[model samples]
Target: MCPPEHFEVSYSINPWMEPDKPTDAPLALVQWDRLRARLVSLGHRVDVVPPRPGLPDMVFAANAATVIDGRVLAARYRHPQRSGEEPAYQAWFAEHGYPVRQAGFVNEGEGDMLPTGARILAGTGFRTDHRAHAEAADHFGLPVVTLHLVDPYFYHLDTALAVLDHEEIMYYPGAFSPDSQALLRELYPDAILADEADAAVFGLNAISDGEHVLLPQSAVHLTESLRAAGFTPIAVDLSELLKAGGAAKCCALELRESLPSTERRREPS
Candidate 1:
């Protein structure tokens, strides 16, 4: 049963994160409560956990992992300090009624997974690795498309690319590899391009609902594009999160499941 492929998606709370280089920029506790409230209001069932001390950035706990089918595939984080998250994640999934499975492969939670349609794209090379790509494809029946990580701090795939609607994926090409481009083209022929600089300004990491895309106020052209495509765009100020390298989008929300999973369909990564 463990080897057999199965399931879709679910969401969870992020612990918190701290920057390694910056000593002055503190991780705020007040923002976390507000973040939790916002997500819970969106009708998500949130399960919060306290982060262990000293690991200020530990709250952005990749150990929490993603669930597809009935299985909890443990995420393999690139940072050594994050490796300890797996044991807890595996146990959490099993206890929560999900079939638990360990992935020897390394991956970043948000960065590695692009689960849509029947295809699931897994990002590697920066916060994740090749082992992750192979394991995800083989174990989960999802074709793992590898995305190359470019730029130093754009450590996760979510940093440069995001899938908005079934047919739309937002990308920052400067960070893409040749293989990544070809793979994306095969899956999405009509992908709208958002420049790397623009994407870095919170253009690409924007999240989506069936009729709306929540974007940063700064993305004028992209916002217009969304409206033209019949989407109501909501803007939120993610200045505090963005200052810490997160966007208005990535800082809080998790794409847990598509209500009508069959209608939206899944795309390969």
Candidate 2:
């Protein structure tokens, strides 16, 4: 995780960003610290990459890269505002002994690529291009299930859905194209459908450690629903960070060892 030492929404790229809106930097830092503490408390190891000036959104480390097995496919952001972040993230991976691979396509890393044990759910239409999914399939040797996001509010797949292991998923269907929604139903019929109110507040962006779920404090209903499903919910107030279009899950990067070598899933010709 990169510290929010220099975080500010100086420019607008998505519907959630507002350059005129004021952000509470101090509050953002405190919230980040609490998130870090919560992750550690839940028995997860935390890593830090020093924050750099002019790269405020670096705090959203999930956009840094997509790591499958030990190979790091660094992000090539669509916006110039975030493109500078690619080299820094790549450097961090190299420093930590992970092999960094150059991505030949435009992809926003984990922001649009979510691994669901059985497959990688890749999102396109906003931040990531469909071509990136093909590149990822070749690089990681995992089946890439592509979904197109239609709602501009849910620019990234991670913003619209959260993969809770391979069996269960919670998502906002309205954020997806009708075809994608149908595909989702075909893939996971019993997936938890997030309500509009909670989804608007980025509730579906919550992080689940299998047993414990870290979500936005405002998602009261989602919390209860999670409990009913036998998962403990930990509400965290990342309101300040929300101003810049990220919350609990968006700020943290999930690191993994190299995926076991496997055959590639179906790719578009």
Highest lDDT: give the candidate number.
Answer: 2
Off by over 4 Å in 2: 258-269
Could you tell me every candidate's TM-score relative to the true structure?
A: 0.75, 0.95
lDDT of each: 0.56, 0.87
C-alpha lDDT of residue 258 in model 2: 42
Q: Which ten residues in a row have the lowest lDDT in candidate 2?
A: 260-269
What tens-digit string does per-residue lDDT give for candidate 1 at 1-269? 01001110111112123433332223334344454555556665557444443333334433246556655566766665556655654565566676655667676665557666556766766667777778777767766667776565556677667767654676766667787777777877777677655676767666665555666677777777667656667665554455445554444324253312544433331
Write model 2 residue lDDT over 80-171, tens digit each, in one string: 99988998888889999998888888899999998877788999999898999999888888899999999999999988999765457899
Off by more than 4 A, model 1:
1-27, 61-63, 248-261, 264-269
